[model samples]
Target: MSQAEASQLLGLAGKYRPYPEYKGAGVEWVGDVPEHWRVGRLGSFGYFIAGCGFPHEDQGRQDEIYPFYKVSDTNHVGNEKYLSKADNYVSKDIASKLGARICSAGDYVSQGRGCVAWKQEANSYSGNSDNKCDTHG
Candidate 1:
């Protein structure tokens, strides 16, 4: 409800509390990080794995093992901060044939392009989506 309330829940979710101290990170996008946190190049932390392009014809199938998530899936009832629901699914054969990537568990799914990114963890990410649940970890 409030900023303070959100911060309190952060602790229960294994989130680290903000450092009492503060300083500019020198990177415009990064803005301010923990006072003691180190600043590095864009890829210094990790790299982004862009997702494939999924045509409309290739989506909306539910007869598969791998889940195909879209950006909208992030708002799913149970997704919250984790992606456990999807509107589409595809079999291994279909995924492989289309050159889709099946991300491993714990991977952070994010938007392919945007000023602010929505990150979420999903069991598996497969196929190209207009919503673009690209993996970054």
Candidate 2:
């Protein structure tokens, strides 16, 4: 989606009225935030993780026993409480080896390459390199 559209969908489009009082946030790019809200770097809240990736053959159409996310999934993420769809799946045995980077519910994922997009997983899931992207809890 275009930046403006994404902003509106993500509720960052200034739909809410401005706070009565405001102070400089110091960063020009981030002029100000709601007066009551404290400002801090995202890192202050959590660490960034580069997810692990499996081989190409390990991903593709399969039984839905375990969901696997990819960059495309971000386009479908909206106001939903959790991400509900994925393009790939794996068997329990494959999942066992891919456990190191299994995305837990509530984790935010962002693509690292082409067609970058982000999504917050609604449930436990997994992904490979294309979607191995960045993640933060």
Report the lDDT tens digits of candidate 1 across residue range 17-71. Answer: 5569777878665566667877777677777666665657868887667776666
Candidate 2 stretches with Cα past 4 Å from truth are 1-16, 75-81, 91-100, 114-132
- The candidate 2 region of ten consecutive residues with least summed lDDT is 113-122
Global lDDT scores for all candidate models: 0.61, 0.56
Best by TM-score: 1
On a 0 to 100 scale, what is the lDDT of residue 3 in model 1? Answer: 36
* Count of steric clashes across candidates, in order: 1, 1
Q: Lowest summed lDDT over 10 consecutive residues: which window, candidate 1?
A: 113-122
Q: Tens digits of per-residue lDDT for model 2 on 29-62?
A: 6666556777778789877766456557877755
What is the Cα-based lDDT of residue 131 in candidate 2?
41
Per-residue lDDT value at 2 in model 2: 44
| lDDT of the structure predicted as candidate 1 | 0.61
TM-score on alpha carbons, each prediction = 0.65, 0.59
